[model samples]
Target: MKQDLVVDSDEALNRKMYLVNNALDEIGFTWCHAKLFMLAGFGYSVDSQLDAIQSSVKVVVDRQFGIDFPVATQIFYVGLLVGAAFWGFSADIIGRKLAFNLSLLLAAVFRPYYWWNELVSHLLAFGAGGNIATDVTIFLEFSPAKYTWLTTFMAAFWGVGQTVAVLVAWAFVPSHLCLAGTPCPSSENRGWRYCWYTNSGIVLGLALLRLFWFDMNESPKFLVSNGRDAEAVATLHAIANKHERLCSLTLEELLDCGEVKDAHDFKTNGYTVKSVFSAAVAHVKVLFCSKKIAYLSTLIFLSWTLIGLCYSTFFNFVYIYIQLHGGNTSGSTYITYRNTSISQFVGIFGPVLAAYMVTFKRLGRRGTMAIGAIITMGILFGYTTVRTQLQDAVFASLTYFFINIYFACLCAYTPEVFPAIARATGGALGVLFSRVGGIFTPLIYYYGLKSGSSVPIWVCGAVIGFLGFIALLLPFEPTRFRSV
Candidate 1:
C-alpha cells in the first residue's frame, strides 16, 4: 500500500488519491458512515474495558494467586507492543478487514484460561492492540472529509467501556474478594472471573456483528493503493447503494488517470514471503518519505510514548493506590467502584466537548489536545492535595475528563496525519511506542513506591504537561478534505 491508483510513481499515487478523495467527499455522511462508526467505536469500547478489567481485578487476582508483584499489566503491554507491530504491519500488507475482525475474535476465543495466566492477558492484549490500531483508520477511510470532526466523538466509547468495567467489578467484587494476606482458591473469591466472562461475551457479540452482519469492506484507499481500482470503485458504489445515493466513480476513469500498483498480482508475482516483509519496510519508508512527514512522525511517536506512560501510570495503578489509602475506609469497596463508574461516566463528556473544541477556528485538533494535556497535568499535581476519598474521586474524575479530551483528539489526528497507504502501519507504530512506555510504567510505579507513593503521579503529570507544549510544535493542521 505504498502509493495510490496502482501507480508506479508517488505523483500518480497522490493524484489518484485526490480523485478518490473527491469521489468520497461527494458521498458525504451516510448510512455506511453511521454503521462503521458504531462497529469501529465498539473497538474503542472493548479496548478501554479490557484495560479496566486488568487494573480493577489485579489486586483480587494477586491475593488469589499469591502474587507479590503486579506484573500482569507489564506482560499485557508486551503483548500489546508485539501485536501493534505485527498486526499493524499486516493490516497494510493484506487489508484492514482481517485485522479488524480477527482481533476481537481472538480476545473472545482466548478467554478460557485463567486470568492470572500471562498467556491469557498477552493474547487478549495482542487482539486489543491490533483492533484499536486500525479501527480509526477504517472509519476514517469511509468518512467524507466534511465529517472528519465527528471522528472525535468515537473516543466517547472509551468512557462507556471503562464505565462498564467499573460497574462489573462493583457488582461482584466487593462481596467475594479474598481477604488481604490470604491466598485463596479461585472457587472462594473469583468474582473477577465473572466480570471477565461478561465482557468476553460482549466482545464476542460485537465480533460477530462485524464479521457477519456488517459488510465491512476493505478500505477504499487500501484497495486503490494496491492497484485494485475496480474493487475500490465497487466498494464505493456498494456504500452508495446502501445509502441509496449515486456514485460517479468508475474503474475506467480511475485507471484512465494512471496505472496502479498490482499488489495482489499473485499470478505475475508469486507474492513471496519476502514481499510481506518488504511491504512492511516499504510502508514505513513511505510514512517518512518527506522531511515534513519524518518530523511529524517522530514527534507523534514520542507523543504516543508519553501518553502511554501517563495513562498506564495513573489508570493501571490508581485502584491499588486508592485501596492502600483506605479506599474501603473512605467509603467501602462499593463506594470506591461507584466513584470509578461516576468518573468514567463524566469522562464521556470529554470527547463530546472535544468534538466541538476542534471545530473552533482557533483551537483546531492540536490546540485542543495541548489544552487537554496541560489541564490534566494541573489536575494531577493538585490531586496530591487530596486528603479525603471524596477528593480522590473528584480528582480522578477530572483527570479522566481532561485526558480523554487529549486522547480523543490524538486518535482523530493520527490517521489524518499519515498517508492513506501507510495509515495503518503508522498508527500501529504509534500504538507500539505507547505500549513501549506502558511496559516501563510498572517499574516507574515500583520505584515511585520506594521513594514515595505520590512521586509517580508527579512524574507522569509533568511528562504529559510537557507533551502539551510538544503538541504545539506539530505544523500540520488537517484540512476539511483529505490532506494526506
Candidate 2:
C-alpha cells in the first residue's frame, strides 16, 4: 500500500494540474486573455525599449561621455545579470503582484535621478530587466493550453517597443546630434535627454496601466503549492465567472489529491529556508530525471548562452558599424536611424511566422529553432560583406527578422521543455547563463574589437552557426505536448 501510494504521488498531483488547465481551457480566449497578453508583454516590451533607446543614442552617448563604445548598453546587460538573482527568488517570497508592479515603478519613477546618470540608468535597467521572466510565467499560468503559441506570438511586442524607441530617436537625434568632424557638447546635444525622458514617460504609463487597467490574480499553482487549495479553486472559479464558463473543478477535488507536490512546490519539514532549498533541489533533480531531459536542458542553456554572447556582440554594435564604417556617403547618422526603424518594423513579423511554424509536425519547435538560427547566422555572415548602404539595410533587416524568429522560438521553447516542478528554476538558470555570457560583450569590445574591423561580427556568426547545430541536439521537443 505504501509503495502504491508512492507511485500515485506524481499522478495525483498532475491530476490537480489537469483539472486547473481544464478550467482555464473551458473559459476559452476572451478580452481578459487578450488584455493579459498585452499587459504581460509590457515586460517584454521594456527590455527592447531600453536596448533600442541605448543603441539609437549611441553616437550622442559616446560623444557626451567621451567614450569609444556606448557603455549604457553594457551597463544594461550587467543589470540584467544582477537583477535576475533578486527577481528570481523574490517573486515566491513576496506575492507576485507587488513584486511585479514594484519593478516597473522603480524603472519609471527615475525622473529625479539626475545625480549620476549612468548609475541611475543601470538601476532603471535593473528594474526593467528583472521583470521579464515574471511576466512570461504569469501569462503562461493564465494561458489556455491550446493557444500556447501566443507565448511566442507575444514577442511581437518586443519589436513594437524597439520600433517606437527608434522612431523617437529619429525624431530627436537627426538635427540635435554632433556630426562627424562637428563639435558636439552637452549643451548642443539635447536629443539623448529627450529620448530618455520620452522613454521614461512611456514606461511610467505602462506601470500605471498595469496597476489600474487590469486586476491580476495570484497564480493558481502558487496557491496550490502553499496548501491553499480552496483559494486555488476559487481563483479558477472567478476566472470562469468573468468569462461566463462553468468550471467543473471543486475545492474538495483538489484537496483529495493530497498535498500539491508539483510546480512551485517544496518538501516541507516545517523548516523554512531548508525546506525551500530542498524544494529547489527536488526541482533540479527532476530537470535531470532522465538522460533525455538532461541533454535537452544542457543544450537549451548552452544555446541561450551563445545567443546572448553572439547577439550582444553583433546586433548591439552593428548599427554603429553601418553608420560609421560602410562604404560611400550613406554613413550619416540620420540615414542610420531611418534604416534601423525600417528593419525593426520588418522584424515584427518574424515571431508571427515562428508561432505558426512551430506547430509543423515535420519541423516542430526544434526544427523551427534550428532553421531560424542557421538562417540568421548566414545572414549575419552576409552582413560582413556588404559594401553599400542598400546592401547593409537588406542584410540587417533579414538578420533582425530571422533572429526574432529564432528568439521567439527559444523564449517559448525553454518554458515548454522544462517540467512544471522545475520550470521556474531551469528557466531562471538559463537566463542567468545568458546574461553571464552577455556581460563578456563589453569585455570583447574593450579588448578584442577594433573600429572598422568586421572580425567580431564574423566570430559572432560562427558561434551562432555552432548554436544552430546545438539546437538540433535538444532531445525533448514540446510541439503539441502540453506543459504540466
Candidate 3:
C-alpha cells in the first residue's frame, strides 16, 4: 500500500513538471494576458525613475527649481542601492506578493516629492530598486520552466517606457514650455509637472490592479521551502485552475518527494537579528561551497558590475553627448527627442531577437551572450568616430540593439543559475553589486568625458568585451540542463 501511494505521488509530480515544461499548458489566458499585465506594471515602474528624470523633469529643475538637475539623477541611483537589498531580502522572508505590492506603493508615495530634496530622490530610487527586484522575483516564480526565457524577453518593455516618455516630451515640452533662458511663470512651465503627475497616476493604477484584479497568489515553491506542504499543493491547484487546466497534485504526494522539508521550526525557533544575519551569511556561503557554482557566481557578479558601469556611463549621458555633437544644431528639442525615440525603437527588437537566437541549437544562452557583447563593443568603438547625424544615428541604434541582447541573456540567466531556496538572495546580491558599480559611474563618466569624448567610449567598450570572455567561464550552460 505504501509503495502504491509513493508511485501514485511520483506520477502526479511528473505530470506537474511536464506541464511546467510545456509552458503551464493552454497558453492564452494564464500565459499571455496575466503575463502582459505584469510586464506593463514593470515597465511603468522602471520609467518612473529613468524616464521622468531624462525627459521633462530635468528641464523643469534647470529652469525653475534652481537646483543642479544631475544631482537628482544620482540621488535616484543611491536610493536604488538601498532598496534593492531590502526588497530582495524581504521577498525571501515576507513572501513575494507582499514585497511586490509594497514596492509600487513606495514608488507612488516618494515620486511626487522628487524635487523637494535629494533625500526624497533617494527614497524614490529606493522604490524603483525594490520594484525591479520584486518584479523579477515574483514573475519568475510564476513562470513555467520552458518559458523562463520570457523573463529576459520582457525587457523589451524597458524600451517601451523610453519611447513613450520621449513621445510625451515631444508632445508637451517644446510646445508648452517657456523659452530656455527666459524664466517664466509656473503655469507656462508645467510640462515636467504634468509628466511626473501622469507617471504617478499610472503607478497607482497598477498597484490597484495587482492588489484587486490580478489576484496573484503566493509562490508554491516558496511555500514548500518553508515547510507548508499543504499550502504549496493548494497554490499549485490555484495556478492550474487559473490556466484552466486540471492539476492532480495533492499534499500526500508532495510530501513523498522528500526534497521539501518543513522549515517552520528553523524559522520560528529564534527570531532575532543575529539569527537573521547568520542565516543570510550562511546562504551566501552556499553560493560558493560548490566549485562549479562558485565559479559561475563569480563570473556573473563580475559581469553585472561591468555591465552596470557601462550602462550608467553611456545611457545616462546620451542626451548631452548627442546635443554636444550637433544634435542641437537646429536649436530644436524635438530633434533630440526624436533621435532618442529612434534609438529606443531599434532597441525594442533586441530582446525578441535574442529570445529567438537562444532557441537555436547552435547558439544557446552562452553563444548569444558572447556574440551580443562582441557586437556591442565594436559598435561603441565606431560610435565615437562618427561626425554626421546619420553616422551617429546608425551607430547609436546598433549599440543599443546589441546591448539589449546582452542584457536579456544576463538578466534571464541570473535567476536560473541559483537554487530555488537561494534564488531571491542570489538575485539581490547581484543587484546590490551592480548598483555599487552604478554608484561609481557618474564619477567615471565625468572624468572620462573631461579626458576626451572617445575616452568614455573606449572604457565602456573594453569593459563589455572583456566581460564577454569571462562569461565563457560560466560552469553550467542553461542549454545543457533542463530549464529550472
Candidate 4:
C-alpha cells in the first residue's frame, strides 16, 4: 500500500509541474512584450520633457517644474516603492496571473495619459509603479531553472526601449526642432507630444492583447503548497502539452514527496491586508534566517543603489557639462546629445557581455559581480581625471560599460537568492533603494558642477566599488544551491 501511495504521489507531482511550466511560458511572452511597450513610453516621454524644460523656449514653465523636479522624481520613486511592496505581497495571496494582468492594465491606461499637458509626471509615476511591481515579480516566478540567466535579458529590454526612443527622437525631434524665442520651428512644435502619443498607443495595444488572449492560472508550486493536489496535476498536464515535452514523474511520486498537505494554515477567512502582512513577515523571516541569503540580498541591494546613483547622475548632467566646456553652438549641442545617446546605446553591451559570461562560462554570480565592480571602479576613477573631450568620451563609454555589466549580474543574482514567497518583495526593495540613490544623484551632480569639482563622481565611484567588494563575501551561491 505504501509503495502504491508513493507511485501515485510521484505521478501527481509530474502533472502539476508540467502545468506550471506551460502557464509560465505563455504569460512570460505577454509580460515581456508589454514591458517593452511600457518602457518605450517612459523613455520617450520622460526624456523629452526633460529636454524641453532645458530648452530656452520653455524656460518659464521649466523653472516652475524644475523647482518641482525633485519632488516629482521623488513622487515617482515612492510610487515604485509602494508598487513593489504591494505587488510582491499580492503575488503570494491573489495569484501571479491576476496581479500580472492588473499591473499591465494599470500601466496601459496611465502611460499615455502622460501626453496630456501638466499630467505627464503624475501619469508616469502611476504607470511605472505598476509596471515595475507586476513585471519583476512575474518574470522571477515564470523563469525556468537552468535558464534563469534570461531574467536580466528580459529586464534589459528597458534599455533597448530607451535606445529605440533615442533613435526616434533623433529622427523626429532633432536638435533643430527647437530654438530660443521666434516661436520655435514647426518640426519642434509638439514633438514631445508626439513621442508621448506613440508610447501610449503601443502600451494600449499590448494591454488589449493581454486582456483578450491571456489565460489565468496559478503557479503549480503555489498550488501544491496550498494542498490543491488535483488542481496542481491538471495544471502540470497542461504545461507538458504546451511545451510538447514528456514529464518524468507520476502522481504517486508527488504524494510521496509530501506536497499534498497545506504547507501552513491561515487564520484569516479571506485574503486581507493582515493576511498579506503575516505572509510577508514569514517570507522576510525565511530570507533573513539564512545567513547566505541575507548576505546576498544586502550585496545586491547596495550594488543596485550605487549603480542607479552613478548612472543617473552622469547622464543627467552630461549635456550641461558638454555645452559648458565645448560651447553651446548648434553643431556642438547636437554632437554632444548624439554622443550621450550613443553612450547609452553602448552601455547595453556591458550587460550583454556579463550575461554571456554568467550563462555560458559559469563564472557564478558572485564572481561576475566582483569583476564588474572592479571594472566599474576603474572606469569611474579614470572619468574623474579626464579633461579633454576625447578622454571624456572614452571614460564615459567605459563607465557605462561596467555599470551595465554590474546591473546584469545583479538582476540575475538577486531573484535567485531569496525564497519564492519573498523574491518579488526583495527585488522590489532593492529597486526602491536604487531609486533613492537615483533621487539624490542629480542634486549631487548639480552641486558638484556648481562647485567646479570632480569630487562627487569620485566619491560615488568609491562608495559603489567598496560595496561591490563587500558583496564578494556573501554566501549562498545560486549556482550550487537548489531552488527555494
Candidate 5:
C-alpha cells in the first residue's frame, strides 16, 4: 500500500508539472502583449505624437483643452490609473484567457483612432489598463512555484517593448513628413501618421496570433476551485501532451483526494459584494496573518513603491534637465531621448543579473530584492551628487541597470508570497500601491524643477532605500519556501 501511495504521489506531481508548463506557454504571450501595448502607449512614439500636435495644433488645441502641457500629462497618467483599477478587477471575475485576448484586441482596434481625435488617447489608456492587469494575472497564475522567479524576466519584456518603441521612433520621427511645417532634411522620407498606423497594425497582428494559434486553456487550479473537475482533467491532459510528460494519476484519482468537490453544484450563490470584499480581505490576511509573511510583503511593497517613485520622478524630468544642462538644442532633444533609451537597452543586463542570482545561488526572492535595493540606493545617491553632463549620463545608465535588477526582483517576489488562488489579485494590489507612488512622482519632480534643488531627489532616494531595509522583515522567504 505504501509503495502504491508513493507511485500515486509521483504521478500527481507529474500532472501538476504538466499543467504548469502549459500555463507558462500561454503566460509568455502576455509578456509580449504587455511590452507592445506599453511601448505604443507611453514609449518614444508618444513623444513624437506630442511634438506633432505641438507643432500642428498647439495654439488651437491647447486653448480648447484649457490645460497646459504638464496638466495634460497628468491627465493622461490619471487615465492610466483609472484603467488599472477597472481592468484589474475584471480579470479576477472573468477567466484569464478572455481578459488576455480582450486587452490585445481592444488595444489594436482603438490604436489607429488616435489620428481621428484625442478619443484615441483615452482608448489607449483603457487598452493599457486591460493589457497590464490581464498580463499580470495570467502570468502569475500560469507560472510554476519552482520557477516563479522567472516572472521578473517576463516583466522585463516591458522594458524591451519600451526599447523597441524608442528605436522605432528614432528611426521614423523627424525623417518622416513634417507636422505643422517644421521641416527636417529627413522629413521627406517619414510621416508622423505612419507611426500610429504601423503600431496599430502590429497590435492587431498579435491579437490575431493569440486568438488563432495560441491555446487558451483555463487554469486547472482555477477550475478545481470552481468545481469543474472534468474540465480541469482535460486541461491537465492537454498540459501533459504539450510538455511531453506522462501524468500517472487519472482525473478520478484527483477527485478522490477530496481537494475537489464531486458536485458541479458549487454555486456563486454565496458570492456577493461582501464576497468581493472578503476576497480582498483574505488576500491581506494571507500576507499579514503570519509574522514571516507580513515582513516579506511589507519589505517588497516598500521597495517596489520607492523604486517606482524614483524611476518615474527621474525619467519624467531627465529630458528637460539634459537639454538645459547638457546644452542640447531643441532639434537634438530626440537624440537625448534616444540616449536614455540606449541606457535602458544596456540596462537589460540587470534582469540578466537577477536571473543568474536566483537560478544559481538560489538567493530566493527576499535576498535578491534586498541586494537590488542596496544597489539602486547607491546609484541614486551617485546620480544626485554628479554635476557634469557626461557623468550624469553615466550615473543615469548605472542607475537604470540597478533599477532593472530591482524590478526583476520585485516581479518575482510579489507573486511568490501569495497563494495561487490569490496570486493575481495580490500582485495587482502591489502594483496598485507601487503605481500610487509613481503617480505622485511627476508632482514631486515638478516641484523640484520649480525649486531648483536636489532635495527632492535625495529625499526620494532615502525613502526608497529605507523601505528596502524594512522589506527584510517580511515573513515568507520565497527562495527558501515554495508557494502554497
Candidate 6:
C-alpha cells in the first residue's frame, strides 16, 4: 500500500508503476468518451416510460384499460425497486461490464409487453432501474482521478433522454391521442406504440455497442481489491498497449509486498453460503466502520430516499397535475407535452453548470450540492402556488433545472466516498433505500390527490428541504477528502 516500501526494493519498478498510472489516466480519457455514448443511450432507455406518459401513452392505457394512470406509474416503480438492488449486487459480484450489458438487454426484451397488459410493460422499468445502478458504477470505475468530475456530466445525457422523448411525442402523439373516456382503438392509437418501438430499437443498439464496440477492461482497482494483483497489472499494461503506449509494470512488481500475498491467501478458499453472508456483512461493516463514513452514508441514504419520493411523485404525475389544476389555461395536450419538452431542454444546463460549480475552490462538491438542494426545495414549494398554465410551466421548469443539478452531484458524490471494493455496494444500498421511497410515492400521490391537489406538492417540498438540511451534516466532502 505504501509506494516507499516498493521503491526501496526496486527503484526502477516503482518508476515503471508511476508511468503505468499515468498511462492509465490517458487511457481513461479515451475510454471515458466511449462510456458516455453508452451512458447516454442507457439514460434514454431509463426514461422511456416517462416519455410514454408525456407523449400520451398514458391516455391510450387509461382509455383502453379503464385503470387509473397513477396506478400504472406505481407498478413501474415496483419493478424498479426489485431491479435496482438485484443489479447492484450482480455488478459487484459478476463484474461491471457483464452486468452493464445484461441490464439493457433485459429491458429491451421486456419492452414489447406494451401491447397486451399495462402491468407487464413495467418489467422494462425494472430493467431500467438495474441499468441505473450499473451504468453509474461502471462509469465511475473507469474514470481517471483527474477527470472524475465527468460522472456528473454523464447525467446530462439524462436530459437528452427527456428531450428525445418529448420530441418523439411531439411528432406522433398530437395527431394520434385516443379521446378521453372512450375505448382507444388499438389500431389508431399508434403514437405511444411507435414511441415504445423506437425506444426499444435504441436500447438494443446500445447493448450491441457495449458488447461489440467497446473493449473495456475490468477495473484495475477492483482487481487489486479482490487480490488479483496479476490481473490488475496485466489490465494496466493492456490499457497502455491499447492506447499505443508502454508500461513496465509486471506481476512481480505488483505483488512485491507480503501484505497482498497474505490477503490473497485468505481469499483463495472456495465459495459457500456462509462466506457469501460473511462478505455481505463485511461490506456493511466497512461502509459504517468509521464515524465520518457513518454520517456520510446515513445522510446519503436519507437524501436518496427523499429524492426518490420527489422524483417519482413529481415526474410521473406533474403533467397530469398541471392539466387538472390549470387545464383551462394549459392549452391542448400537445402544448402540455410541449411544456414538458421545454422544461427538459432547460434542464440540459443543470449538469453542465454542476460540472463547473463542483470544481470551484470555494464551492466544491458538497457546497454545490447543498446550494442546489436548497434552491430546489424553494422551487418545489413555489410550484404549488402557481395559478396559471404559464406560471406552472415556469416554476416547474426551474424546479427540475435545479433538482437535476442536485441529482447529478449526488450521483457523482456517492461512489467517490466509498473505497473501490465497496463502491458498488454503497451505491446499491442508496438506490435500494431510494426505491423503497419510490415504492410508496404512488400510494402517497394517490391519497394526496384525494385529499387535495396541492397536498403532495407541499409534502414533497417540506421533506426535500428537511433532507437537504440533513445532507449538509455529512462529515466529509468527497472532493476535498479523496480528490476524485
Best by lDDT: 1
Q: Candidate 4 on 77-142: residue-level lDDT in tens? A: 454555555655566656556655565445443222222433444444444443443454455554
Residue-by-residue lDDT tens digits, candidate 1, 105-205: 87764343455467889988888877667998889888877778878989999999899988999998998777776667777786877888888888899
| Model 4 segments more than 4 A misplaced | 1-71, 109-120, 130-137, 175-189, 212-216, 225-229, 248-269, 318-333, 360-362, 385-393
Candidates' TM-scores? 0.93, 0.90, 0.85, 0.77, 0.75, 0.86
Question: What's the distance in Å from true for residue 223, model 1?
Answer: 0.6
Q: Can you write out model 6's per-residue Cα lDDT over 446-477, one digit (the tens) per residue?
A: 66555557767767777767766765776656
Give model 6's clash tally: 0
Error of 6 at 474 (Å): 1.6
Per-residue error for 6 in candidate 4, Å, reads 23
Runs off by more than 4 Å, candidate 5 = 1-69, 109-119, 130-137, 143-146, 176-194, 259-296, 319-331, 385-389
Top candidate on TM-score is: 1
Estimate every model's Cα lDDT from 0 to 1: 0.80, 0.74, 0.64, 0.54, 0.53, 0.65
For model 5, how does the per-residue alpha-carbon lDDT over 1-484 read when each residue is reduced to its tens digit?
A: 0001011122333344334444444334334334433332232123222222322222223333343444434444555555556555545544555666666565553322223435555455555544443464455454444455556565555555555555555665545533443433322423444555565666666667667766667756555544565776776566556656554436675555454211221244455676666555553565565565566566666665676577677766544454444443234435545665676677767777776777644465556666776777777766655555466567767877777776766766665556444455556566666566767865765675666565655675676577566656655555654443
Question: What are the per-residue Cα lDDT tens digits for candidate 2 across 154-259?
Answer: 8888888899899999999888776666676777788888888898999999999999999888877556645667878888889889878878888888878777
Candidate 6: segments with Cα more than 4 A from true spot? 1-28, 31-56, 110-119, 246-248, 258-275, 316-329, 481-484
lDDT of 3 by residue, 234-292 (tens): 77677677667766666666566564321322445746777667656655765675667
lDDT of 3: 0.64
Error of 5 at 199 (Å): 3.0
Off by over 4 Å in 2: 1-9, 92-95, 109-115, 180-183, 261-286, 317-330, 447-453
- Output the worst ten-in-a-row residue range by lDDT, candidate 6: 1-10
Clashing pairs in 1: 5-260, 6-260, 6-261, 7-260
